[model samples]
Target: MNPEVNEDKSSLYNKVVEGKAQVYFHKTKNEVFYNPIQEFNRDLSISVMNTYSNVNNNKKLKILEALAASGIRSMRYALEIENIEEILANDFDQKAVDLIEENKKLNKVESLVKSNCDDATLLMNSMSRNWKSKFDCIDLDPYGTPAAFLDSAIRAIRSGGLLLITATDAGVLCGNGADTCFTKYGSVSLRTPACHELALRILLQSINSHAARYSKYIVPVLSLSIDFYFRIFVLVYDGQMKAKESINDIGFFHVCPECHTFYQQNYGKTVPTRGNVKFVFDSTSPYDLNKCQNCEGTLKLVGPVWTGKLHDKIFIQHLLKYLNTKTTDDFKTRERMIGMCNLAYEELDNPLYYILDDICSVMHCETPNHNVMRSAIMNCNYQVSYSHCAKNSIKTNAPSEVLWDILKRWVELKPVKEKWMGPEYRLARILKTQPKIQVDFSIRSDCTPESKKNNLLRYQEPPPFWGPGSKPKRKAEDEENSKQQNEKNQKVIEELK
Candidate 1:
């Protein structure tokens, strides 16, 4: 068969991306193809893989991309990363399989990367049954929730192997679809300013619960919330002691509907164990409140989510080091990734974050500068750092009461011009009697100009027709624009050569 004839028959086009691999994908519709916006996601994945490989010192690494769409990820891994023994790229759709085969050949990695057509779950289960713990890395980047494939994928990975999972069902995980989250992830989610962080925790909790059933446990090396989804890289191990320790990380939350004061309760800690393996509850601790402490309003219970450290500090440092040593042009999101790594490295291991806007809104005062708030919190001898989940959020170890007191003091310094009436009057009356505390109003230099430069790299304006929804069917103009961009990139590559 003539290659040009075959390509013409399917109306497929070849595009080289990230300076690494050339892939064949449909132009008019992305329903059965690739999404260019996910380049950051892929870049980070490669960096993590490189770091993990170096840390393990594995000379022959095996990888599995369970839901490989057009085999771009697998091809990139084969071309860009080192020490790869094999890559099994699987997709259930025959058309996708055909494209994967063609792309695999196009990239000249047919000997290293293999394409298979089968249901992802069944394929993973078969691998487990045939060769248990065979893969050094297993990637599950399904279209939506990866919950369905977690069980099988966990069983198929070698002990100490990395498991990469992505969940795009932010609506459910972020609490917009509470019932759906409970049904799928076996946890309750709350839609709050920190919902993105909560979403990451919820996904971790679900993975832990599933791994526990097979005497396995996961230690999250890196957990991040990026555009449109959340991704986690965890190292899975097998041991009774490890599984028991994993149980200790399982916990719940108590959020006040009125003031948004949130509390966390771990299973074995706050929820004490009784003689018959039952829980002993006490009013003074975990079950301490039926009403909001600040406003005397009802408190809603929110979790059973993971309350462990989201990112391993040392691992993040290593990832940054690896990126720094590489001179490859494929990592287009390098600066943005450095910014994210810097934040993750410094962020406190606290469970939840506080939104500055939310805090000021509650206090009925103008929003204070983030640096001022940070300085004030630090003056009180509490740790604070910027949260990667949101731009105006900070994760601090300061108690809610202390935070409220700081806000109350700020309000006193600069009184609200709006007349005090109704809830505002009630709040002012309540805050006036609180103990007065002095705060340093000096500006903080936590984030430097260099850090801002790194962050600015990730802030590209979206396309004119961008909106929130599933990946849309590309129109003719979209395809033409993409083709032009590809040509321009190729010309740049030629010039460099």
Candidate 2:
């Protein structure tokens, strides 16, 4: 039966199976919610938690699925992840929590999982008030943006705890609604070819800002721009000194609208000393931030994004090691997990990326092969890699001058049919000045990344898309009923527990 269809008011539903658990979803009404396309999301969450469990085997985990509409993910965590002491499957709707309770029994994980009905933010804030009530891992995968619950979620996790966040409001976070993003996340998001990655950074910066409220900071274990949403796993730790260091990670991107070249301006800087690196913030500007140095076009200033590393290299290496031991049936998206992790590991330690096709479009030239472009940049003695963010992305430490020079060299080899040599044409404006740096188009043997050579699935084949704020909510009365149930949910939790 289609999970989205509404059937007769009778208690009729279909059983759905994913990973190691089966749960019932209403064929008619809103007792609980389920989306089969989230299998990859659930699988990757399990894989990451399993890896986290292995790496931190000594500690027992207290996990909370903050928005457990169907409790499928919470059940899977109980059944699959190791070293777990207990799991709280929480939802605002009492009916959803009731289904969670039933599913816990059906899955025979009754001892490990408990159902709770309460507003997610209220539950988390209550947990934050007590040291023992705080969770070791908190997963928030609400329909649209998770912004409404971030502060409470950050405060509720234990130090060195893991916080998994899912954001499906791609429109708001991807620059379609800059004012909304700023209102929701306290950061303005811009439209760019690398908007996915920008979304990741914006979310991280928001979480990081929230973390600072309690003298805590985040270390991103894995930051991904997945199919329909952005899923990020970050480890939270508390220390005033360490929290102070997060300043180095906060920054903005100055993008050239014409040529698509980007320059990052970090809010803080770190200067290498003889013994220890000194942390500095509000430092003097290193790059001319007023305008695009290359094209002289107006530079659009974007973000107060997380300028720090998106993925933990060592953690991803171990994740790949963990995936190598798992079978396809064990995790259907295992290859994708491994592939994405590989690409994340190989990504240059840089902020944002330029899409090759977008750049070629600006130059009005034939698109050069990724390998050839990558080779030219690498041959220039700069590290280069594919941002797990985009297929034709160029993520390198090469200065904009070298990249523009390479494009000039490409135009030299395969010239544009017609050059619109006018001030108005972006192409003319970009190529008007001679390339100051030498560019070599010599193809190298290792141009293709290992992830590509191995035929790994580096990009997503997105599931059915959802518009902004759309996650299959019920009609108005049902939503109001859910709200009323949530308002009084906390009062009845004692009986459920």
Candidate 3:
């Protein structure tokens, strides 16, 4: 296959990634192209698709890559996955469509993959008009937020079909850009250690809200916050009752600004009731004041986000089993996948997580080993599990006081570090006088084990001089060199002609 020329007269580079799929993309000074960092994202998507197919007994699955730049992801799906009937790789840019077609032929997947040039939302909406034309799976991996495409995507997928959505707007979803998040997602995001988890929930909430408009609801099979983006795989279900019922999962959080204590309150859920017993929900009264019970500090109310389970344990188990059966050259990614799935599988279906570093800092003490903290919490009969959001964080059912008590005990055993002593005078004083609680410091079997090796899958270092922040400028000498190289490539193409 020949390389295509971009509008700037730059020749595209045809390269192979993940040891199998070949992609044609431009890597010039002015062109934006493929990112190697998302290899793990693509890898996980393939695995999820394979597992979903197996579990659902799906055959002849049709997929739509809504934002298929260069068609690498679509091509990868066709080449790597089984039981794929067809893949429509669509991009708004004609240049991208040309590259997608070239890559499709290069991979010899012309029969299985089709390339289209159209606005993603328009294409999906048009396809949704036909009852039989909806795809079995629609992958919306846009460059930024996927919110704009969620409505069309939901309409374009068949009932019980999978919708794989990627949101790279971490800043907005993770609370860095709170106003933007609320404006786009209709939810407030908390800037806390557990913000990544919140980010996943916020995205899900957005998807759920959009689906509800069409009397459809989503069941999140797996949700991941990896690197600079969040990916969620959900199965769409159609039913007015089910859609309305799913609204119970949408709620807001009251988070303490001082101590980071947070709690969720679901909308239309007022009084507590027994199992299988229905109670009248009072919508007239407002939710209790956003006040911290522990610190008496005014809590910051954030969200109207998804308060349901992020990952289906059964689905993750199936994914792990699927991973066990497969082998790949990207061992790092595979290992990280295993580790992350394990963590996600066991994580408490809790809303927010407590960062050990933050907890220790609050107590004016050196951070104890995570295992030690886990053991301390578990000794108190509180369930504790590792968080995928942060390394030193744990999702637990323990109350704030209990966690602080554990930290207090640790400080008594090992006095606060000198540097940490002066600023937190109140904490230091309390720690020095607080009675030591007798708790076994031994690591418990339930404590999450540290990965034996580094998992570089989540965040991979970008190639030198490649990033959105700073573009590499061509030097006076490098410009001449690039011009000569372009001329040489053009001459080669002419010779072939």
Candidate 4:
């Protein structure tokens, strides 16, 4: 029976048995066998499994799959992850529990897997006295928002525990339905080209802030965007410093459409900008959108978001090594997982300008001018723009057109402001007048030779990618180039003297 058919087959849904998936209906004596849709919950469960399996030294880890639904996720954890010692699958539905029980027995893994019929929220809330600090990994895959279970989930995970949350309600997070997200998560979602990423960041920030309210801190290890679901894995640490650090890294901000301006104040730096124009009425209030002056586009207000980069290269490399040694088709989903991982990895550092000059170096892709490269990178979801001043381009996390507008403002101003104030300070003042740029988050892409030298100094990569040949060639080029650059610097210094 096809579960999608929705013919009272909820209890009789079939599952994979052994390597080949077999569907056995308990309600009827008939056994139907066929391949399942790749888009089913099972596929998601596999992705979740593959991610956690990347966790190192999990031998003593206690894993919980709250709202275990079909218990497929729990079973995957129990059977696949050798590091996981204790696996708990909890669901309020007694019938689902029974099915889980049967599934565990069918796989002959009853000893490793435990099935419980109880409210997942209750189970998580009781961790204070019942489990205290027992669990290491808590998976929360709910039917919708997952906000209702957040409080309990936070309490359940131990210090240095891993919390994997999945929110399928993308509409709310993307600001398509802002009122709903505000009511549910106490966060304002923004609508923009980067809305998808903004939604995930807001959800992560909500979790971090919610955890901090209880004196907890969370450092995100990996965040993935898969179809309609948003998955975030965070590590919980105990201590006020940890809590403050986590909260400090995630924040809220607003953008103005009319002026192509934005205002972002970190957790500790909360001073309101003193200017004639103000996009944000409240310093710590929810985010909102306004109208753009230049283009008349509705400015998107984004945030209540995370600031830290997503994928940890160390973690990804470890997982890649593990995959290389494995002889199973289990690595089938590796391509998709790696794609998301690479995106997160690339975004870990402060995103810099992909100028026509730098594009060839970073991506090894050639372009004619800043205009063409800017257009291409923007199409690839990267914010890119051009300038005629010291640094001729800038690229960052904000949306492309928004950044372009800011660049235009700076261009018209022609190196505006006092020489004493830095780029960020001058940019902030410029944003004060142009409220549209005030709401977007951006960083300077002014890459000097010294900075480029520093970046190359600490560049890390796979063996073949960063082998002797790679650096030797670049080192030879840099040595010869460095001499000329030093001479030019000396000429300027002598002229100043």
Candidate 5:
């Protein structure tokens, strides 16, 4: 036979007769369907499994994969992870279920995998009643939004269950379709340069919000951008208040134009800047800045941008505590986990505020209300305020994601900064003179003697009112004007009386 013909025949046999894909991944061998995309996902799934194995305490784990396209991820988890005690794998397609059964037997994991053909939503609803506290981990790797199946997935996951979610619609979360994002995900999108990081934060917050309905606390253990998708590994611990607190950690960006600098603050703390400084209180918005501070030249905002740090050193340390355990089997898996843990620990700090703000803004715009945006702005360690109309021009002279990048010099504002006594004192003096600005001073807090004295010295406070004797009376021309005013008042009083 000709060499070319022979090669073609072999390729045909491997694909058609032998039932194999391009890559022969461990625990993924079977007699049927294959996909390279699924292959990559399986690799990721196995890594997660190996990590779970290190922490399993020999307890029975119930794992459910809602949408098993080729049963690749389910198959790998079932066959490889020793810690996985039981799995209930479901696929809506009957043919897919058949392949799942075959793969189960081929991998000798049939005893562990219980394959079924049913809509994931239906299965999740049915499981809600009987499967309460049943599953130890629930993985949802869907084709797109995962929004249609999200409520059910939230319900199916056992409290304290691991919910591994993957969102492939990067464009939507990254601010391409701001309206759609708000409509579907209940959030807004701000396309900043650090858009990917913003994408992750928005996704995490959306997941947290969705999970909150089921009384779950989602602690993000791992988050990464992979294969045109965003994946997050969150541990769903049981707690109402803790979950509320977790959701409240979202932050916002306040951009400043004067200094070509943006002020980033959170929602939870007091609003740092005043409401009106020459008719504009915020001096910032969620948008990017146009000018450079130092040279006045327009600068660029480059991103994948993460404003907060990626990981907590203490959290990384806690994860590493399980590294030397005997339960973990694969060296490669161990290395990946350790690397992720370290990156999260070492690089994660400052909470990625720039990215967090954009994320929340994107998500906020997507949602029907400003709840998520408000929550994020309300709870951050700093302060944030909302605007009804565009306060500044949206046109940025620099890269759209410029502010998404970390500032060259970050001034950590002191928590105990003094209040703005200048404005308050000026207003107080004005109130004393006019007394009829229709303003109320009862809401104003008393200033310290030193603060009051300082304002007096700084020319911030107007001179105090003095008796008429302290200054010459009005001039003859002014007296004539006063007499005319008195005559007018007498006429109006006489008419009323």
Candidate 6:
């Protein structure tokens, strides 16, 4: 489990203070691991752990930071969370572990925080061999996909323990590379506006499938798709039957690439009888994706993603409620967390969301305000909610046909440009069809969400040109020379222009 490498940094700070932990690193040379923007990520994790401890009988917890980096998160856990027996902050790089050691001492949490320089997966694998030594909670915040560690993570967690995972490979998970997504997460990701939500589901299914191999199953507590990555929290429990039943949540997404209509079909079926519900193999109907039922566009298959509930309603409510306690008053991301939690709590259990703009773009019509769209959906007596992932998102139970019907009615009032009305186009196929129901666009008071009404930070804008910062180049001396050379080259090019 030990690694041998040049102690080169995935870099660290001169002195960066976050929460109650103050970290000190030897050099600021080549930046790699530390991200100040993730302060919100840290605060959210602490709040969730606090809520978890409170909800789970205040049991003292043993935690593992699988990729500890500079140990900021571990140190924060040791300080902020109420009941913490110990934390093992492990990183393969010797320098990172050394930095962790120094920061743990600096934070004055040496007793509760331990630093380990070993391969994270191998260390967890070894711990998984000993049933009693498994961690109560394990956090995986790797540079890219957490899929590499998911198997060991699933096996290394104690029964009913929390598993926090982060995946930042948004490009692959959002469908730019479906094959790569399959290689990492064993699912096909689709390119759609709801890609973030799709990414969350894909990761959840990946973890659940890995757990299924060892007769365990996951119960997702909260799942979030943040600015550049996906963070998911799920509880692991040991049960052969429950693991078998996980198939009910495993499914594929059928999408119309042109129009962005989607349908979710699970591998298992729910059979509800007089007084009981039964889970059975899906034998009655097998979907054949030939064309979009709404616009006759080509149907593309994208899945097998987790089709189950992304968050436990009660748990999300508990998290939102935890923010109000006096202990969390110092949280810097408190308002943002509150807004996200409110959205997650209000989010429908539907599989995917439609962007109102994306839908209207097909018709070349003006996009209705989200409130207007919300009111229209409610007027049709269908349930709807906002997905926390995207603004202008419409997560609803209404079928695509119904949605097209409403759009058809809208076009009747305010027609689209004649140039877009070609009979061969998807727009024409949709609008030429007759409306099935009486469409209503009357605005409703309840259409405005509570989060919006209170002006909570529902959609915080990322800093301009935001990204995970780049890795530091060669040495400080070489970097200086390269910078000068690039500047001189740029000056010559500018003069030529």
Best by lDDT: 6
| Clash count per candidate | 0, 1, 0, 21, 41, 1
Instruction: Give the C-alpha miss distance for residue 296 in model 5, angstroms.
Output: 10
Which lDDT value does model 1 have at 202?
92
Give the runs in model 6 whose Cα sits over 4 Å from its true position: 1-13, 272-278, 283-288, 326-329, 471-497
Give per-residue lDDT, candidate 2, residue 54.
81
lDDT of 2 by residue, 53-146 (tens): 7888647789999999878998899888878899999999876776677678779999999888899999999999876999999999998889
Name the TM-score of candidate 3.
Answer: 0.84
Of candidates 2 and 1, the better by lDDT: 2
| Per-model lDDT | 0.79, 0.85, 0.78, 0.56, 0.50, 0.86
Error of 1 at 366 (Å): 1.6
- Candidate 5, residue 61: the lDDT equals 69
Order the candidate numbers by lDDT, best to worst. Answer: 6, 2, 1, 3, 4, 5
lDDT of 3: 0.78
What candidate 4 gets wrong by more than 4 Å, as runs, is 1-13, 17-58, 130-133, 256-263, 269-300, 348-371, 374-497
Poorest stretch of ten by lDDT in candidate 6: 1-10
lDDT of 1 by residue, 46-128 (tens): 88998898887745679999999888899999997778989999988777788788888888998899988999888888787
| Candidate 3 Cα misplacement greater than 4 A, ranges | 1-11, 268-290, 330-332, 412-442, 448-497
Residue range 1-497, candidate 5, lDDT tens digits: 11332233334223211112121211223323344433334554555555554555545568888887557667667755668777888888765676566556556777888887899999887887755535777778776676677777777777756777778777887778867777667766556544555677667667777777767767766676543666777766668766555533555543322222333433342232566312123323344345433223344332212233333345345456655452324333344444434434433233332233332232121221223322322232222221101111121222322321111101111121233224343222211222111211121122112212333211112124311111112254477799999999999999999
After aligning candidate 3 to the native by TM-score, how far in Å is the CA of 27 from where it should be? Answer: 4.3
Q: TM-scores of the models, in the given order?
A: 0.86, 0.91, 0.84, 0.62, 0.55, 0.91
- What 10-residue stretch in candidate 1 is worst by lDDT? 275-284
lDDT of 4 at 146: 85
